[model samples]
Target: MLLKIDVASTVPLYQQIHDQIILGLASGQLQPDEALPAVRQLADELAVNMLTVAKGYNLLKAEGYLISDRRQGTRVAANFQADAVFMQALQEQLHQLTAAAKIRGLDVKDVQELVAAQYQSFEGE
Candidate 1:
């Protein structure tokens, strides 16, 4: 899994890590039961603190997106699926993005086309 971090972005480091992992999982770049790097290793790779990476891992574990064990290490949940809350969050984000686009003078058809394009771009990945 490749993760890109933008230190200058307003988004917090931990959230950035968490979001990228989620996107990886959604896009099938990550597999179920695939082990992620140890917290210290990931922290080193990202030039961040261990606790920062651990915080993101903990959040994912709490949401059932990951499983962590001292012996086996951290892995994607074997049966991970977006729950209702996850779906709702996605819908909320879409709503916000479409609203912003509308405010920027994009019509409904334009927004729909953009969404369709994005969805299609993810196909057969």
Candidate 2:
């Protein structure tokens, strides 16, 4: 998987990394049991500090999207589940996105069509 960092963005480097990783997982670009790059390696590639990469990795681990061990390194969780907390957070994000769409004069059907297209795009991939 390829990861990119936007140095000038308002989002923190670690967060941008974390978000991309999450999207990869959700979109099936990163598969279960897949090995992730070593923190040092990823940091070097992204031109960021090791600690920054570690922070993102730790967050993913805590969120149950990744598993890390000395012998196996870090891999995507083999059996991941989106628990109540995760669902709630996801719902809030969707609400915010839909609200923005509405403010931009997108009707409910327009938003639904966009959502459907995005969901189908993932399936085609």
Candidate 3:
């Protein structure tokens, strides 16, 4: 897992970590039984404090996306799927994208065309 941290971004460091893990989960990059890097190790890799990684892990744990066991270490939660809240969050992000695109002068038709092209390109791969 390669994690690139942008310390200057407005997004909180913990959220960057959280979102990356969520993407990893969705893309099947992280397996259910896989042990995550120790929080300290992840901090070292990202050159951030252990607390940042721990905070992200805690959030994921609370959301039932991962589980932390002292003996077995931290692993993804088996059979986990996005809940209603997660889906709503995703929808909100999509809305933000559309709003931003419109603000940048992308008309509705242009936006739809762009999305269609991108969707087709994605499926082609």
Identify the candidate with maximal lDDT.
2
**TM-scores, in order shown?**
0.85, 0.89, 0.73
Which residue pairs in candidate 1 have backbone atoms (N, alpha carbon, C) closer than 3 angstroms, thus clashing?
none
When sorted by TM-score, best at the front, the candidate numbers are: 2, 1, 3
Model 2 stretches with alpha carbons more than 4 Å out: none
Candidate 1 regions exceeding 4 Å error are none
Question: Which ranges of candidate 3 are over 4 A from the true structure?
Answer: 108-125
Q: Write the per-residue lDDT of candidate 3 for residues 72-97, one digit (tens) a residue.
A: 88888887766898888779988999
lDDT of 3: 0.86
Error of 2 at 81 (Å): 2.0
CA error at residue 11 for candidate 3, angstroms: 2.9
Tell me how far the alpha carbon of residue 42 in candidate 2 is from the true structure, in angstroms, after superposition: 1.0
TM-score result, candidate 1: 0.85
lDDT, candidate 2, 31-119, per-residue tens? 99999999999999999999999999999998898999999999999997778989998899999999999899999999999999988
- Per model, how many backbone clashes are there? 0, 0, 0
Error of 2 at 118 (Å): 1.3
